[model samples]
Target chain A: MSARRRLSLGERLVIAAPYLWIGAFFLAPMLLIAKISVSQSVLARPPYRPIFEPSDSLAAIWAKAQTFSFDAYRALMSDTLYLESYLSSLTIAAVSTLIALIIAYPFALAMARAPERLRPMLIGLAAAPFWTSFLIRVYAWIALLKDDGLINNALMALGLISAPLQMFATTGAVVVGIVYSYLPFMLLPLYAALERQDPSLREAAADLGASPAQVFLRVTLPLSREGVIAGALLVFIPAVGEFVIPDLLGGSETLMIGRTLWNDFFSNHDWPAASAAAIALVAVLMIPLLLWERARLADEDDAR
Target chain B: MSAPLLSIKGVSKKFGAVVALEEVSLDVGAGEFFALLGPSGCGKTTLMRCIAGFESPDAGTISLSVVDLSGVPPYRRPVNMMFQSYALFPHLNVFENIAFGLRRQGGTRDAIDARVGELLAMTQLSAFGHRRIDELSGGQKQRVALARALAPRPKMLLLDEPLAALDRKLREETQFQLKEIQRLTQTSFVIVTHDQDEALALADRIAVMRAGRVEQVAGPMEIYDRPATRFVAGFVGETNFIEGRLDRNGAAALVAEFGRIPCEPGDLPDGARATLSVRPERIGVAREGEGIAGFVENFVFRGETTLLRVRVARDIVLRAAACHGERHAIGDSVRLNFPPGAGTLLAEET
Candidate 1:
């Protein structure tokens, strides 16, 4: 009989390969960005280079050694345009997530309460948009929401607007685009959470003499908090870094951090400034992420 | 006679082609502990839902204190239901769960708190008020569910298999506690359960249901002593049936070739074929040469009693339960006897 052998080096490597790949491809790139954020920019034909040469005196090397510098960060904080764009992105993401939640909640509830035969169809309808390319969907929205697009044309033909209303190329258009793109992300989690909720809880609440509205607020909402939080995170996190929807539908009038970062990197060739802005966004995003993680852990503990 | 506190009159319900309940009618007296007992698919749940306004009957009306409940939503009804699964809100602690109903009626926060505290004390869940539903044991969850349902002090309360989730030992203990709580509150309680022992022990009266209709409704003892149908007789307790014909002797009795035995007619028409049912406990067993001779087909020695299956006649088996001290082996000759007034005449098989 063959003896049970210890795991081979090849097997161990296979098991650890995915993590290595992630570290190499994902974490390495991010660390590189962190390194470039503090380094001085060198202007050349390439329009960007590291400031310090390979060889220099110990003191001079120390002085030029990508030593802690807050110049890029200082530029991000003091610049009014960067500050405005950051604030705009935050507000737009927050408002769009909230709006998506409002729309998704009732839709999820209806799907939850629907007959078994109909549930799959309704859930499929909610999920169908996800199969398509998100960029393509945003482009489709641009076509529909533009000033001279189908929406304005139909409204003008119907005399709803005397002239084509300025719907696209604004903050409202950016929010609409974000909400539209991220709605399925909100719906799926909310649906999953609501579906797992036992109907007995609502019945128990009613039996306890709570009205329908009271049941929703007290039992339904609280019980579904995990899903709500998860759905919010799923939408808000991606919407914060969203670039395609705003670019296609929001036009130039909508100033956002994503657009600003894109402009800094590609247009102005300000690699250090772009990296600094990216780091700041990461820091801002981490606060909520940590809090959400703690809440999620607490919820899991409660479940156990 | 005062009017019944709750009356369900000729109520019927249908789900498409399926009949969930049919012509179900009953009255619950004030402070009565009524139970609806049946096997699964017997419409006890449908009837309970109808009373709670979760379901509206397709025909007939339900009234509580002469107030027609037609078109009344569950929230507007002065009734509550304790679901089979207890249905305690997982998100809310016991205190908030019990306080939910009171708060919804616009009660003052102090009033809600006081009532909830009182209920917690009543259900012996005062210390558990801050505990989440999942944190509770099965018995504690049952109590919290009861407290939550009763917190509103509705005119009537409904319990659907309230103790079904508890283990057998805990179930037996909770049955008495449930009865005591109902008595103490004096709120009309209509509990629905398929467990015959649970219904008999907890209910003042049990409505035995079969296939979407009530077969009989009577006090526990009466339902056991005089079943209204063959279904109720078989469903409620063990019985041995002897095929026979009605014997008119001023009083009715079943006359078989073996002997004549007195029995209740049980709505069986005169000259109709019927079977007389005698309880296994009531049938006497004796050794050969002691009484009517029969061969013991099988004997089971239970701790407290010995149950013997005897072939009294060709293809006719008679079950006899004897005290544990008696020993009767299989193939041993035994005798059987039916004590006076023990058998009940059942209607002819359809």
Candidate 2:
């Protein structure tokens, strides 16, 4: 009876809370960035020209919006720095995501196949890094990868290398840092997908004359595909706009869009250029992800 | 049995301290429909898995057509098992799932297609061959699992309670279809089931197991009419168990208040305690008869035969099945007679 009843006022408000939070915190800020991206930067307290006044009527707001500038977007096309930073950011994130997938797949498989009593401990171990601050974890990589860091010291003491290797302040170091930081992001989804698989399916495949390798390729691999998609997106999307790992570990030449955006915002105080760069970065990342999400949802609909 | 297709000898398996199966041995004849029937934890499934090569026995050997299978892996063995959950691959359509084993064996596309097409027709799933697994009904999914397992045409087919997931009417239909498929394919089938009626209906021979050991292995009629042990008699069908002492000549069992019930005592020593088992239908009930007289206590309606529980003495009620012979109300006087060769005397008590 209660399930069929109409929602009360309190229930309606409770259900609307999450949508309100997203509109206020995420959508409003993103709208602000978009509005600033189309405006000219000025030598004023706000830096960028205000698109509208609070007191402006709808007619007045429409009139003001027509005069908005595309100068920041035009500047972005003329300068190769913006284009190269975007390309580099995409390339680095793609590589790091690929590396994370390779390492996390086997780890998640092993965890899923482990004895039941040991599973809780394995999950806890994977999540332990989240308890520590993310920045501190990235900085800790410096202690391990720097010229006189623990790795170099250990290699030298073991007579494995004649001198310290240039492990830090390189693109390779940045990739390693990102892969390490987001290993859990890739692993949790893959683990969930693999764990949800019915063990009987594997047994049935083998019984149906599938060799072990064939079983993995035909059954295990195909069944765990949803996990692969979720994990790859989780690591790729955030890594595209990452600032701390690239800034802390990468050399000066290893310029990602996040660092370029930061430089435009802080060093040059060009708010319009930084906002435009941020919007472009989101567009570049969201297009592929949204396409994949659309395809995945369609598959689920067909399943029903 | 024409010839033994699969043979298991003195196979023993233990999971830590618990013995899942102990010295279990059996043979499945070629083209014979066999069933391993038991309650949960009775080792029927364990024995089936050992034959399938999913589990290795700790003590003995399993062989197919006289070839030792001690180190043979499941994929290499000529056996396929349809799981209890039906375990159909969700990612593949029905046609692809059936063709999975064939693809692994690596034949031409046309050959695979022909075989899959034949199987689809056999299972009456030709129209649904392209449907996704989730889009199919529960009964349809079960048929898909069966068709997939049978595609490879292994020497022996193992069904692990394959019909348990279906509803009552669907299960009955699937059971008939399963036996039909087995007959058409001429594949040796070893189905494991806990339902006695299912085992009795489908299996050519049944092995009733208990506590990790075989209690009896016989045909359906033999198992019902002539169970070798007390456990088999009690588990297979409804029967009245009467604890009594073996007569001096070991020809009959002397039940205390009900007098001597005639039974073959075999090699059991005279004066030894024995249990007599008599099927309800074996009992003949009439108002005026030369037999034990008791008051009808209760009635249970079973369409063809109505079962009447007759109270002979305090706390002593014997069930008699009447087939449109006589009608008696509760508290009505009735006479019950155990027909000639009607009861089995087992030396052990349940």
Candidate 3:
């Protein structure tokens, strides 16, 4: 058969679509940032050295590219500000994801145990937050947590406190914003896992002389490991790079990597330095997640 | 005689307005392989659950070893159930699944391992100890479930449709195996099954249930030969029901279109309506003029026996089974006769 007739046009397009999407959207932008991270900054348009000029010869371009260095990475290493920002960002993400898991686990369990007729309504309510803008939801937390906002007013009205509490512009506020915004992300996968569990297993455990607490500890908790892994990773990965919540809800002292990268790019106008920081953040966040993913997949293979 | 091992009296349960069980009572002997046999929604499972303490009856007392089991939870009850679905823990391997009960009771690691190992060998799952539950086939999983429940060595074991998941050949094999295991363990077994053959083959005594009540409880042979009600006779096996009225002589016989059928003696006013149930295998077939003439309707050639439906009168067809190789074609005339006391007279159903 001729080359064109070997494979149909429709089949070829279907095979190529996913690769094309990843190439155009993910690989190209990542490659651009990587290239910029190794270049030097200069007082010029785009503010980076060793630009790929169409008019230059290959030899000339190669000679100019030799000037590119790892200076931005070196700066990040020497400065404690960036180091502290990375550590604090990781800490905040870990803590917030843990809190979200705690809140979502019981909610998902309740949803799974609910009557069949009421389950769809329960799921829709858990997912209802997605209908509105995420930013608006975070902003709503600001409204509730403000010193003179609804919470304070209610507490004072109840005569439970002598004065309004200082609630906003703190690390607590940032954590609250993340947990609220990502609650659905943590709950959905957990619900899926818990809902799929055959309740007969629990009954069987109880029949085998395990108490309720024992059954939960030995069976229910261990069986939902996949959902726990997925939810923790989902919340942790995005929270590490979260910029909007920290910027809007956190006080001036909050120095997560996202805010640091934003300041380096927009405020300091240092594109190469920001790129270097982003790369460092990704590398640091990926190692643990990849290890966990490998372990989960190995478990799945064994189970199958 | 000693007191019954498990005694359930006046047990009644309702889910909202529908009665799941009503005034059910039973006394299971020690080490007896008792079966609760019924169709779906017939209160057999509900009754089993009540004994297991997964559910509490609205009114009644279930005493294990003469000790009141009221207010006791399933975990606290000295009974373990092999669920209909098996319900093997997917996360735990066979060894751990069997060891779960031992571990919960807090024994030494070595002791738990030894008991689990013994059970694995007992169930013929010795090499599958480390395999995950999902890796095992359906029959293998059933063994694991049985092993797990038996590991606890409770005073009693409740099995709900334990062989329902197996294919026909496997079910027959497992039926004998289950009976053998029960004999070896010497534990009072309450097995719930809707398969009447399974009940007959495995149970020492079977409780036939229908519509939230027990119709009769008797040995398998007794149940087959003398079912207390028409429903029992119909449900347990195929039988020909000859509807007729009692003779005016106050004798225990039914006069139908075929003729007078002698039945076991029962109290009935003269001319009262009654029925006689004759098992197919009990009826003999021979040549024409030797007995009542019956034209063969059709025959089903089962491997060991051929079941022939013979019409003796208008609207009165009797089923008779001949051994394999006994050829009888449809529309052929044959003679059919049963012994004098082969049929059992059934009271008019309430």
TM-score of chain B of each: 0.95, 0.96, 0.97
**Candidate 1 per-residue C-alpha lDDT over A164-263 given as tens digits, one digit per residue, 9 for 90 to 100:** 9888888888899888888988998999899999987887677666678888988899888889999999999889888887887776768889999999
Candidate 2 lDDT at A115 equals: 96
Off by over 4 Å in 2: A1-7, A50-66, B1-3, B248-256
Each candidate's lDDT (Cα)?
0.86, 0.91, 0.90
Q: DockQ for candidate 1, please give it.
A: 0.63
Model 1, B1-350: lDDT tens digits are 89999988999999999998899889999999999999999999999999998889999899999999999888888998888888877777889888878887787888989999999999898898888788889889889888888988989999998888899999988888988999999999999999999988989999999989999999999888888788898999888878888866577778775666676776667777888778888877877444557888998887888888888778778888988788778898877776667877778767
Candidate 3, CAPRI quality class derived from DockQ: medium
lDDT of 2 by residue, B1-350 (tens): 35588888999999999998888889889999999999999999999999988999999899899999999999998888889998899999999999988888889999999999999999999999889988999999998988998998888889999889899999999889998999999999999999999999999999999989998899999999999898999999999888778885634555646777777777888888888889999988888768888999899878888899989878788888998646779999988887668988788654
Query: Number of the top candidate by TM-score?
Result: 3
What is each model's TM-score for chain A?
Answer: 0.88, 0.93, 0.94
lDDT of 3 by residue, B169-196 (tens): 9899888888888999999999999999
Off by over 4 Å in 1: A1-15, A49-68, A298-304, B249-252, B264-270, B288-291
Give me the displacement of residue A40 in model 3, in angstroms.
Answer: 0.9
> Which digits, one per residue and each the tens of the lDDT, describe model 2 over residues A71-151?
898899888999999999999999999999999999999999999899989999999999999999999999999999999
Candidate 2 predicts chain B with a TM-score of 0.96
Model 2 pairs in collision: none
Q: What is the DockQ of each candidate?
A: 0.63, 0.83, 0.78
